[model samples]
Target: MQPDPRTNLNNELAQLLNNRIVEPDYKREITITFRVSSAEKTRLEQRCSGVVQSDYIRARLFDYPLPHPKLVIPEVNRQAIYELKKIGNNLNQQTRAINEAVKIGSQPLSSNVKEYLQTIKELAVLLEQTHASLSQPISDEE
Candidate 1:
């Protein structure tokens, strides 16, 4: 009696993840094979972007460029951050001058300016709390 086609396919679908120990170039040669349930294989197929599974495995096992798209981390905009810091410094200096003039009775401190100063003080409290929280190690018991 011959094996049914679906049964043969089920056999093909079984995972073959066992490995033989060998010298490391991460591979004995540039071939890798694995089998799994059809659903898992379908999901894995998406990751390889239609490249032959063994070849995709080889590309990943060694450090070769992938035929498929790779993950990209966004770069930090250092120049923009530096400009922001400069603007913040300028605002701080202006705020200090306004406070100094008000203290010496040379400037009339309006309600809006007082509200801005209150907001700045609250932001400073929040900044201090954030800094202290970050400065502590995560494993400490206190």
Candidate 2:
């Protein structure tokens, strides 16, 4: 007995129908809700004229530019800091020289040495003041 051709044809047609392609849509799957005053709604609709409401809202929501933070160092402060560092290095070298001279008994404590030490202390105070001033937030008045 021969197999039925109609049955085979029916099976082929069913297979082809089952294998047909289906394209997907591009719509999002989530929904959001918010309350707005009637005036605000009117303003938004006016701004969104000639564009779809959802597109305008989505662009405003997701494509807006955010303000970035900034670090500003004033030129005066930079120059002052550089000068302070140089002065600090000079003070350190002078202290080391005095210490070495005292250790070797080459120089004795004298009025000139005391005056130099007083000047170094004054310079240290000035450096601290400059650093504190630079670290403070800049005021609008300045």
Candidate 3:
């Protein structure tokens, strides 16, 4: 028996980590149709990896290059990123409140401003490290 189309699609998609051309094409007005199981369609969407569905289909069908498939993000890293963003937002709010206070002369501008800036820099470095670590799973290393 012939191999399943889904399996073949997966195999073909494994090599899709190259960049596509940047020119516009007018011949893409033609349409193609095919049937896929619901689960297979989900798989296709997953493999599309943030690209437009039609673009993904055309690349697959025409044997063109595509970006690295952005599959599942790491669970731990995802949570950490969320928590860090929350903390950053809260910090920013507090800093803005302090700035407003200083602007209104209700509070004196302290030398600790330098210290707060240093803390923000540290937080930025930490977030960047986390971002790089989280990106490791989905980023194309090839």
Candidate 4:
């Protein structure tokens, strides 16, 4: 007796559908379509920053907290950054001068230079603390 061709085709189609349909409560295996204005899309992208668009959208849809983006250095921080760069350059020059003096068997580091280096170190510590404070999370109470 020959098997029914219709039954075989139905079975194959059923298997295909079963494979494609995801069980509920599983990681997303379905696609959702939506549209947004260009301005809204841009804002969303900017807010998400380093996050993938899909993940960001999902977080919003599900009311999950969005991940924080890296902090932008404020104008005050920018000035601090410039000062740090200047300090670093001066330190480099002082180190080079000291090295040259050592090569010539002469003392190159003056007391004033040592004091300046100590001041620079202290300034660096303060800058680091400021940066840390800036990056810290603010509580809603505050």
TM-score winner: 3
lDDT of each: 0.63, 0.74, 0.74, 0.70
Q: Which stretches of candidate 1 lie over 4 Å from their true place?
A: 1-95, 140-142
Candidate 2 local lDDT, 1-142, one digit each (tens) = 9989999999999997776443433677988989999999999878865466666776565553322223355888878878888988898789888878977889887889878878888988888888777866555577
Candidate 1 global lDDT:
0.63
Best by lDDT, which number? 2
Worst 10 residues of 2 by lDDT: 63-72
lDDT of 3 by residue, 56-120 (tens): 87677656576555456778878887887787787677778877888998978777975785687
- The digit string of per-residue lDDT tens for model 1 on 1-142 reads 9889998776666533233222336535555456699998888788786467665765766545567444322233334445445655666787798899999999889998898888866665665564444444333254
Candidates 1 and 2: which is better by TM-score?
2
Question: What C-alpha lDDT, on a 0 to 100 scale, does residue 86 get in candidate 1?
Answer: 68
> What order do you get sorting by lDDT, best first?
2, 3, 4, 1
Shift of residue 140 alpha carbon in model 1, Å: 8.4
TM-score for predicted model 2 compared with the true structure: 0.45
Q: Put down candidate 4 lDDT per residue, 17-117, tens digits, no spaces.
A: 66664233556678988899999998988878767787677666655556655545567766776776677677667767766875787975778767766
Deviation (Å) of 49 in candidate 1:
46
Query: Between the candidate structures 1 and 2, which one is better when assessed by lDDT?
Result: 2
Worst 10 residues of 4 by lDDT: 17-26
Rank by TM-score, descending?
A: 3, 2, 4, 1
